[model samples]
Target: MTRARRKPMVAPKLFSEIDRYDEANSARLGLICIQERIPSGYTRWDREYNLDGRDARLTCISPGEYGGVPHGLDGDFATLLNVLYLEQGSPESGEVHTTAYQLIQRAGFPDSGQYYQSLQESLDRLKGATYTASESWRDHRQKRWTTVKFNIIEQIDSDTEGGTAFGVGTTLKIRLARPVVQSLRERYVKPLDLTFVMSLKRSLTRSLYRMLDAHRYDPANPQEPAAALRLPLLQWARECKLVEEVPARVRRNLESAHAELIDRGYLKSVTYEGRRAETIIVYEFGDLPATAPAPEPMIEVVPDSPVTEALRRRGVAHPVARRLVADFGENHVTVRLETFEAMIAAGYKARNPSALLVDVIKDQEGKYAALGTSALPAAVAPHARISKVVGDEDVDALSATLDTEFRALPPAEQAARAVTSVRMFIGKELREGHYRSLLRAVQAGDVDALELQREATRAAAELRLPEFAEGLRRAYSEP
Candidate 1:
């Protein structure tokens, strides 16, 4: 008997790198436009999109060949760029040979007829879609601006039988355009977690992730993370395709997006500087402790109102009181204030009302639990077990010991030890029961194991416990 030939198994590409800031920064500033879906048929137009910043400006103009502003290009086109970026042998080589199946798998798309159709459509769109970008950068010492125009793909060479075998026997040879290739060669790239980016389902969420990844500060630099991007609410709304939405509606969308990002471990927290219409939204990115205190819910409160007066009476500083009243609402503040007043009336002599108030609010851990909100303040929550193992005292002691040891070691040994120390600390949290609780939550169906694992990984980075995070991930994945 003759046996049928079996297809060779393909290993997962798993990761890819791109000029992290290139497309993402442009998207954040309203330069690259994304559409939810491709139009039913071809369309074309010309338009200019502007990305204005404190020290830089980027202007993007859509070419007339492809439908005005390459809609939906960010996802598939980005995936293609990542593939090429990863596979390229040299900076000068622009041609990349990949099978349709390989592209589908790498792009995180399903291997199906519909997906194949969509991929072909995307390729066509990308071929015709071209844009020009004018970038301006300025500082105290110097300023510069430059412009470049390029197509997403300079050319595509393909070999395939026009049969109904979904992408079978199809091979694509893609040559990336010059400008993008040059950008990559010039080291205008930022590191990205391709797995994380590809896993995001929504186009907007993916765009935001790219933007955050592009803007993330290098952790090794030992400086404060980059300043939060502050964008006027209206301008942000326009970029997010909510230009017609009222301020309240826009705020709702922004909050919802922020919560989603926080849950996914891409955001530290989101803060707004002003109220309604004039609001300046700040997107802060960093690792956050799992036990961080929750943010006060946004609610309406009059400026300089009685609530502020009551807080002042309680010895809360003016700025602190104003922030609390604005964020937590009059009703919530009044309740807390009443509780404090009642405590004082009971002959309680308080030396620090401000600290006491903070403690009281924190003690009521379930106050906002019912709201199902994830974005929270950075106040450290009390964790008896974790505190014992990786407390501030332990961290300080470890730092001091490392510093002393470094002085005694030769340069090569010191460098090795420094890397090993960071690696060791990232796994320190494994000793606690946090992973047990996480596993239980996953088994109980309260959360997804993969998502919980991702969260643990992110938290471990901040908490300096990588080994523990890896072990937990293994536990979740293993039978």
Candidate 2:
């Protein structure tokens, strides 16, 4: 007899304190590693600040072993938090037992080798990491910042006895530290869109997105549909884990990451104000538009046409084909059909042809350009306008390398080149906005243009794009 196929398991939604809009866990959480790559060995961070007239101290210790602290709490760790919290029925619960496959599925990760590997890594980091916070009130409560210590996960008990394919049976018994559990039990968590969080490509962008999303205006309160967060440059830098002491470098790094958030539609706009001693950054949250209802299916039966036949042959539904022909003129339909056929011939898969065709018609010219193709008439040479040039993919790859390259430059040269590299990589509109924001930071005495320029020259040499780098250098060097 054939063995019964195991039914697929469904994971539940994950939650976190950072998911909500609250000041408590706002500045000092050591949960995310803001760097591009995990640093080797244990990393420790400590800071002291005054919030709402109360003095506070925050300290985080990331163990060297177990892959260091997590890159951020959004992706895998967020999923793990959800799984553990849900299993215990309360965040304050000390310990719980579960299997690796259960956590992976619950976290919404694929049951694959790579995902399992990542799950193990997150578990290791969580078990080893620790956080502490101390606060003293100004109203005669305490003079110095008092401290309380806690671990994210106090301990992990693993069992790998039942051998299964891909190590799926590895069981984990986890104990969450009391302080973290209490914070969660007290409703210090924010509700977030896990799908949107996962969609963000960069960790910094993801963290910033969550912060802004937490501050989004509640629809129930018509008087205030949105909220604005004003963060001082130094504090912002500390919170973002961008730089330790330099405000100018912090501004440069923030503006670059902010551009990505704006492009992804997570932010509406970012403004900056320079003061004599500090720069202030203002973040504005945009309203997420309600998704429009699907269009009514087309009912008309059109006359026999090549476009209709072509669409039908390509598995486009009859109603969708009719709608395309009716909505878009015959010529537009014909061109898109040809392009779609070309893409198919070139091994491109149109997973949702109906939606893809709609997008294709809407941005016809840009779509062709984006696809690295030219829309030429059948009479003209088809490959005439298909010139060899750098594509977006190449630019994206270069952009990632640019950060590492910029960091390698001398400290004096880093700020300026960082700004220049951002301008070159992002779109024209976004670049302009970023420059304006930087100028605000500069005028407020938060950043120095001369320093930025000095760094740009060194960065240019490193990039080996002297012309482009020098052009930017000159622009900054000039009045």
Candidate 3:
């Protein structure tokens, strides 16, 4: 028998400090400033590859490359830059380009190829509404060459793009290295778990180290009898001060094994239901400052209209009336009615009858007012009839409905201006009787009902509704 020679495994290149920076910034791939210049000639304009290929005319800067830019948030620009490098090639291909990839690679990343691929996919997914390129030359008479610059508004992926949860805290940029991913694979994570983890990994891990450090446990004492160290590191980290907050669902799962954490000296005490429950026996690891609570945003409530003099004659509580004035705006009796309803919903149980009466003023100057829900017609009706009787013009009705519903919620002051800007949303068609009914239903938690009111007002014309639509979308969006 002959002995077989064994092959030695090659050592992996060490991950670089720059790799850490890239991961932290979510800019692992690199960034590029693409400048394309083409003399007007027989350059093949591949309409098949563009968004509006055939319909699009070829200029000095043609539309051959539409889906080839980096997008998805600010830091993701690095990834976008990386993708452009891979797809478009270099000046060797006769296309002008500049990149920071070579600089990044010099920093030492074993998995630079994967990082490059992430960049490529991100850029390839880009689609643009319009593509414009400028043609200019510094010395036009001498060189006779075009210095072209293309301007693109790339599409953004909201999910993968990093976002702040509390809106007050610093954003976490997640870029999991190949090593970390491998480690995760070796643990309880399975193939199905890989899919699940990939979906959540971006948000759950990015820049979490500092937070994890905050909550790290000391090994001195064991609080629970069944402590084991094989548990998830994040579970222990959450128990420590490193990550002060976990999603509600995750916290629930931790409760069952919390005692085990204590037994392993990974936790000292867990707070629950207004009391501290000691689970871990040890406290020697030293204490961390409690996580700072996120500050509540300030709100400025203002009435849309002036109050009637008759109401002033009755002498309502000056502070309470002023509060209403500030919250509901000056000219809007409709807003005033809505504000009162909001106060009631917020647990002001001793209802004020006077507030309701003051809310339904006839407007001495003859500005139209919305009839309360009690006054709505009993059956389906045309827009013309509704407008004649109640003055519910499409635009006016849209504004009034949005104001009444959105103002009642605790939204930021900036949101108020944004919400009432839309003519109508596509979601207004679901309600049956009246727009007011849909508004009230929204307050009462009938989400589908609210969409119906919005659908009823969808217009066929171009609209000045983007800002309002954004606010409305945020308002109804699930947290």
Candidate 4:
């Protein structure tokens, strides 16, 4: 078998925005679904219960030869689903395009052979698993609780024009199920702060975050996202597919996950309403941080009519706009909108303009921020992207640009940024002091741009990266 090549790791861009639909509630494959290995003959998962006094049933079955429904690691497919929706452009958009490696990076997993194989397996399980939500699912289009059957992904095919997942140059064409597409058309089914969700340490915590966020947020009133949610403990366990009904067992199962979320600031507290199986788990959300914990809360639910309207004018739904302004403030939301608009004007084709706009507002990639005049690099070119090298001239040009940018900063600030930047690319602390000196040498003209690039590239190769020059260049960029 041919070994899959390693792609260089550039700094992860902030532009990776992910969203999901509420219609697919209770169908969390890996998060809430079984985590154990599936038996060869396994084929289905079914449960019947009451959801808010309504009869609810959930059924997921494997339509393909692949068995046991989408369980275990298939949970990570949530990342792929959000990416698909972010790029889907429209509920009517039958398909979206992405790559295996892109999904892997967004998943925050290491870029290695094992993960590539894991990605492929996850995709197969997701494509094969068909979920049937009976009253448990919401049909936003019809505005009613109804029985709905759909696959999170209707089909997955290798893009003829693009490489498949196992190869270096790969793109996957994913057909979205009709229901999912319909949900995408809505103003806000549920847009996840995937950056925050993905940052969680456990799949269990990640799963809890998604389900709870979906509950706390009310799409119709974006200005006031729900801050608290309460659910029957046993019902919640059943909803999460945690088979244990004993209150003690359920609480024990959730104990660590709840603690992790609280410590991470995603949850302020988790309280119980009763003892034993009769208990009701009450959860309150913490105030949104922009991303992680910035000094100025990056994301907070503030009400702003003007900003919300601006988003609406740009084809963003009233609710989504409100949600944007509510979660992220007016300034951040407006700048990103203007930037995306400017990029479109500059002939940047967007499959989903609204979705892209939503993505950009919350930590967009620097490359996409060019059209806006908001202290962003006028034109931060991708001089050395993953797996590719630039000419000596390109490297020299980047160095010159960095020099000019550096001169404008105070000496102390420049030194601070340089140290921080160099440390990130070095990957290991053992080499930190050496790289600091090396970075100073380049800044002070003791080293040329090409040599520094090669040195960094060689170091990257030691870590199994094919072309790590991207890291060397990206290290200097602070965004």
- The whole-model lDDT of each prediction reads 0.46, 0.48, 0.27, 0.53
List, residue by residue over 172-241, the lDDT tens digit for candidate 1: 6577766655544333333445556666666666655654544443322211224356777776665553
Q: Candidate 2 — which residues are off by over 4 angstroms?
A: 1-30, 67-70, 73-75, 82-84, 105-112, 136-146, 161-166, 213-226, 243-245, 251-257, 275-277, 288-479
lDDT accuracy of residue 454 in candidate 4: 36
Alpha carbon lDDT of residue 13, candidate 3?
16
Error of 2 at 46 (Å): 0.7
Please give each candidate's TM-score: 0.46, 0.46, 0.16, 0.56
Which number leads on lDDT? 4
Candidate no. 3 TM-score: 0.16
Q: State the number of backbone clashes in model 2.
A: 8
42, model 2: CA deviation in Å? 6.3
Model 1 ranges with Cα > 4 A deviation: 1-31, 38-68, 136-144, 163-166, 215-227, 238-256, 286-479
How well is each residue in 131-162 modelled by candidate 3, as lDDT tens digits? 22122111212422122322222322111112
2 or 4: which has the higher TM-score? 4
Top TM-score model: 4
As a whole number from 0 to 100, the lDDT of residue 100 in candidate 1 is: 63
Candidate 1 yields a Cα-based lDDT of: 0.46
